[model samples]
Target: MPLILIIDDDPMIREMLITAFHQENYDVMGADNGKTALDIFRTEDVDVVITDIIMPDMEGIETIREFRKIKPDAKIIAFSGGGSLAPDGYLKIASSMGAQYTFQKPISIKVLSEAVKDLLGSCKKKL
Candidate 1:
């Protein structure tokens, strides 16, 4: 089974993603903040990461960079609502920072799941 790590400050958002992945029969792990997310990444065999952009302790971009340092093969997807953060280019920056893709807020589970599938498919190794 594949392991997915979810990092978000909002408990609601974390819960929603957890439920969605659970429905898909994915093995899911949840973190309420980026620090915990990184901790999980370091300790667990995470296949992919889904993280919220605006988080306390460590933001998504920084998390991506750090995770890349620890696990260059880790696949990450950054997401944000764009409220008070960068007005634009959130996804672009995340991609530049090594995230496979980024998602705007109010994301559809179907779209996110499709993106996840596409990313995993393009990987050199099968999960």
Candidate 2:
């Protein structure tokens, strides 16, 4: 089974994603902040990362950079509900930072799941 790491400060969002991925038969892990997420990333064989852009602590952009440094080919999906900058602004930064996919807040779990599956399919092709 593929392992997915979900990082978000909002408990409800984290739980929602966890449950959705679980139903999809993916092994899921949750982190409330970028710092905690990175620690888990270092230890686990995470296939894809779904992270919120405006999280407290490390924030999503920095986390994406760190993930790239650790694994240049890491699969990442970034999302935001908007902050000082609009969600689009943050998502653009995430794309430049190597996030393969981006979404706005109130994301459809079905779409996110399809993105994960598509990303994994592409990864398999690369191997």
Candidate 3:
């Protein structure tokens, strides 16, 4: 099964995502901050990362940048509830920095699963 790492500060959101992904048979790990997420990333064979833009320790944008450096072809899906600026601004930056997909807050798990499948499928093709 594919491994996925989810980075979000909200406990409820984290649990919700975990449950959603688990139902799809994907092994999932959750982190409360980008710092911890990075630690897990270095140690695990994470196939995809779903991160929130606004987070403590390290923000998702910085996380995505580092992920690209660590693994250039890292599959990333970034999302945000919009901080001071609109969510689009942050998502746009994430995309330019190498995030393969972006979504605003309250994303449907069904859609996220499909996106993950599409990304993984594309990566396999490239290999």
Which candidate achieves the best TM-score against the true structure?
2
lDDT tens readout by residue for model 3, 1-127? 8888999999999999999999888899999999999999999999999999999889999999999999999999999999988999999999999999999999889889888998889664321
Weakest 10 consecutive residues, lDDT, candidate 1? Answer: 82-91
List per-prediction Cα lDDT, in the order shown. Answer: 0.84, 0.94, 0.92
lDDT of 1: 0.84
Deviation (Å) of 61 in candidate 2: 0.4
For model 2, the superposed segments whose C-alpha errors exceed 4 Å read 124-127
After TM-score superposition, the amount by which residue 8's alpha carbon in candidate 3 deviates from its true location, in angstroms, is 0.4
Better of 1 and 2 by TM-score: 2
What candidate 1 gets wrong by more than 4 Å, as runs, is: 122-127
User: Candidate 3: which stretches are off by over 4 Å?
Assistant: 124-127
lDDT (Cα, tens digit) per residue for candidate 1, span 1-127: 5788989899998999999998898889999887898889889988889988888888888889999999987889888887565624776788899988788888788988887777778665444
Per model, state how many residue pairs clash. Answer: 0, 0, 0
- TM-scores of the models, in the order given: 0.91, 0.96, 0.95
Q: How many backbone clashes does candidate 2 have?
A: 0
Error of 3 at 112 (Å): 0.6
